[model samples]
Target: MTDVPAHVHEFDWPDRVVIGTVGLPGSRTFYLQARTGRRIVSITLEKEQSALLAEKIDEILDRLREVEGNRYSVPTSTPVELVDNDPLDTVEEQFRAGTLGIGWDPTTAQIILEAHPLPADLDEAEEFDAAASVNSEMLRVKMPVGTARAFTQRTREVVDAGRPLCTLCGHPIDPDGHTCIIPES
Candidate 1:
């Protein structure tokens, strides 16, 4: 058995970072890709994870904007020039993301995102220390306010582009058919 080197694909300021999918809506595979120039890192993620990440990022930015004397320039919406709607570049799955983390960086006024690979031992504790997880492979990304806003905007659009919801049960309707289990009144 050979050892796989623990790699940390970090992008301080990427030119493009977006959540995109491959395949049809119901059977689609979600991916989080970040690129700086020619270097690109793509990590597979679940649809729920992608949606929650975007929501949390927006919540953080919204809170920051409400700060009484906020020195940072937090945009209320994605900058017109920064709005990215292009398809993801050729994806090469580096790993399937298990633990996704996001935070705000005040000093640089950037949003930080980290994606850690699934642990080898499924039974082990899931808590992760980004600084201490040196033996694992992960991707770390930092982006400014404008870029972060754009990311969340694009991500929301991608997530919503999936199967339409059934108004009766609020569940996604399948392409073939949908059996909504309507609740008894």
Candidate 2:
């Protein structure tokens, strides 16, 4: 990471400070909050560097959010369509032909159709409905388990923090005596 330019305001305030600077490439804005409870730091870049840094920061933040919560163990379910008589053989054939690609696991499968921005005629979307019917195979599509788990955890956290609810029935429960009853199956 590049260092902040000297011309940028560097304040030693006990509470909070806002700094701005303009360098060779672009300008930057920074907000530094020094509190007894928690310290917060936010930085913003201006032009080309801003876009690049924003993308990098977004990726880093996404990974961090995923890691902060224990949400790496969620399985995503995909819809599998069974065609005619032989589902297994058709799925195998599609996989072998590379038309239907599988992800890290055999469960995650997707139609490998090219959709590039060149040769508009060739870029037409291929309809797989007829092919899927004739193939007589089951489509095994899989979703990213880790991503889904992380998202679910994040959403639950947000809901919990914003509006407290009963863990069992999702109803508004008392903050103090919120008992969760688990019925025997």
Candidate 3:
């Protein structure tokens, strides 16, 4: 087996970028893809990674709009769709996310996202150094604010398409049965 490389890659303005999933609902695998012409880079990340990115993006855009109002800058609206040619156009992942960083580029009106790999979750063990695990590798993707917002919105939609949650408990309701927490009558 080949070892994963450690490096930072920058995609200034990719032709297409999308977050999508594969497999059945209970076993879906979340992946992020960025394509420039024929060049394609696909990275698989935990579901939480995608969800958090979406949340952060919404938060950032909201804050930016509040600060700048309709005055600062935003490309005119267009249909927001997650576009990808054949899911997993590439087989292997550049890296799975350990941590992700998001930022707004005022000059270019771009939303920048940097994904770092985590070899181990900190809560897994005391020996696991979260900081050290964080800097293992980085994959940075930069796209316009409109595109970023679209991706975030579509990603959240895809994520929420999973199993339904129990009304009594926030946990997913298994197909077999849900161990819901309810007050005894």
Candidate 4:
């Protein structure tokens, strides 16, 4: 609700926006990347954050579709043409994301996502507001509904590509070994 901060890396209708990662499954580091033409911004985030971001975006789209006229053109699934299965372009961490924001813009019918850097004071991390007009650098991206759907699809795939889940205890099975310890009933 404030002026666009000078530290904000804003991408309006980016050419490409995705959640990608580097390193192997268990030790992998997730990144949210947005590119408009030659300019690209990559920010590091947690694997769980990536998963939740995708899920929330999809939920927003689903709710938008349920609107009476369905005029937003929200896709039920990722359009085949927008599917991006390629690896990340390059690895560069602009910042470590501590807070994330997601919302819809009715005028443009675009989904907006913002990633804010972690606070210097670990104790104040909980109080940092990503949406507030603070003098902090952040990455903000707005993409159409189709691209949003595609982004969520890719994000879910990337998150799932990590360690497999144990059938019994429902915990990730690490590469070395996994012991599923069932709790007492």
Candidate 5:
């Protein structure tokens, strides 16, 4: 695998927006921004829900354009009356079932999710391995090209901050001191 370009960087919370794709057909792309911390997420779907979502986005952009400034106000979500099933619940279930693969870039504070075929059972090690490899490949290939700019900007900030903490010990140390305690035979 090619190294993630030097430009890709980590993101800070609240200030960053994450974009990703989801659903079985891989047709749904979701753009989520964290509000009031990561607990409250505002989502904007693109090229997924198709006509309805497109219409809503167009309406919002139109209204914003009318204001003659880069900024405009729009409702984050619309309340929907469900007769029986909750859409959010269904979506959550699919996520938990591994029908979705969620990727989060800490530097850019962006999340990318894609609809993927999952292993039939978590206990099946062989199947899990195959599924995981496929998922990883898909992520590398399908990652949005547009996010590179934001990712690069965030990475620069992180690099300026200094080196990362040790993944094994979670301790911050100078590069020369970064040794794993695990003995090699």
Candidate 6:
């Protein structure tokens, strides 16, 4: 629609951006939203994708802090906002998320999030970095240290909110319970 190249979309400096989800367990829909002034863009993606992105962001920040000092690592997730945590009340997503990239802009001191459509044949794709670039659809959001930290924390909470896992087996246990056949000792 934009008639532009497949480069990462830019939200150079958004006032706020956070990763969130909607719906209950078994029907949960993960989303990433970026807001700048009155403009807001939301993209949906698989739950695993969100989990991995959040984890990677935290890892990147941690490593950056170790090498560059406290400037980037000083920000930690803030108190969770009840309104933001509730999925039933969030904005309608523009589209489902696909490939995700977390990057740091040293000059601006902001974290960049690039969410794009999944490559047509990811199974045959040789590299993840190449896959994301092949698609023209992308939504990029740039957030400061504190915002990025909050996004990471919130994402973790949402992903972990699924059904509890069985002790013997790793899969989630249904309400009726599970046999959990892990070869008894």
Top TM-score hit: 4
Task: Give candidate 3 misplaced runs (Cα > 4 Å).
Answer: 1-6, 69-72, 75-88, 120-136, 175-185
In candidate 2, the residue pairs with backbone N, CA or C atoms under 3 Å apart (3 or more residues apart, or in different chains) clash, namely 87-137, 108-142, 109-141, 109-142
For candidate 6, write residues 1-185 as lDDT tens digits: 43443554568787556667676676777777777777777777888988898889888777776775576554544535422454423476665665667888887778788777655676887765544454566787887776777778878888898778876678787666677778677
Candidate lDDT scores, in order, read 0.89, 0.28, 0.74, 0.90, 0.34, 0.70
Query: Candidate 1 overall Cα lDDT vs. reference?
Result: 0.89
How far out, in Å, is residue 67 in model 6? 2.6
By lDDT, who's the top model here?
Answer: 4
lDDT of 4 by residue, 43-159 (tens): 999998999999999999999999999999888999999999988987678888888899999999999998888776768556766555345687899999999999999999999
lDDT of 5 by residue, 96-177 (tens): 2223344434344333433333444667664456345344222211222233234323323322344457677665556566
Q: Once model 5 is optimally superposed onto the true structure by TM-score, how far is the C-alpha of residue 45 displaced, in angstroms?
A: 19
Off by over 4 Å in 1: 1-5, 121-134
Q: Candidate 6 — which pairs collide? A: 44-96, 44-97, 45-97
Q: Between which residue pairs do clashes occur in model 5?
A: 9-155, 10-107, 10-108, 11-106, 11-107, 11-108, 11-109, 18-110
Q: State every prediction's TM-score relative to the real structure.
A: 0.88, 0.18, 0.77, 0.90, 0.22, 0.76
Ranked by lDDT, top first: 4, 1, 3, 6, 5, 2
Give lDDT: candidate 1, residue 107. Answer: 83
Higher-lDDT candidate of 3 and 4? 4
Residue 54 in candidate 2, Cα distance off native in Å = 1.2
Candidate with more favorable, higher TM-score: 3 or 6: 3
Candidate 1 lDDT, tens digit per residue, 27-138?
Answer: 9999999999999999999999999999999999999999987678899999999998899999999988887889888889999998888655656756744344435788
lDDT of 2 by residue, 52-72 (tens): 322332343345345645243
Looking at model 1, residue 167 earns an lDDT score of: 86
Q: In each prediction, how many residue pairs overlap at the backbone (N, C-alpha, C within less than 3 A)?
A: 0, 4, 1, 0, 8, 3
Error of 6 at 133 (Å): 6.1
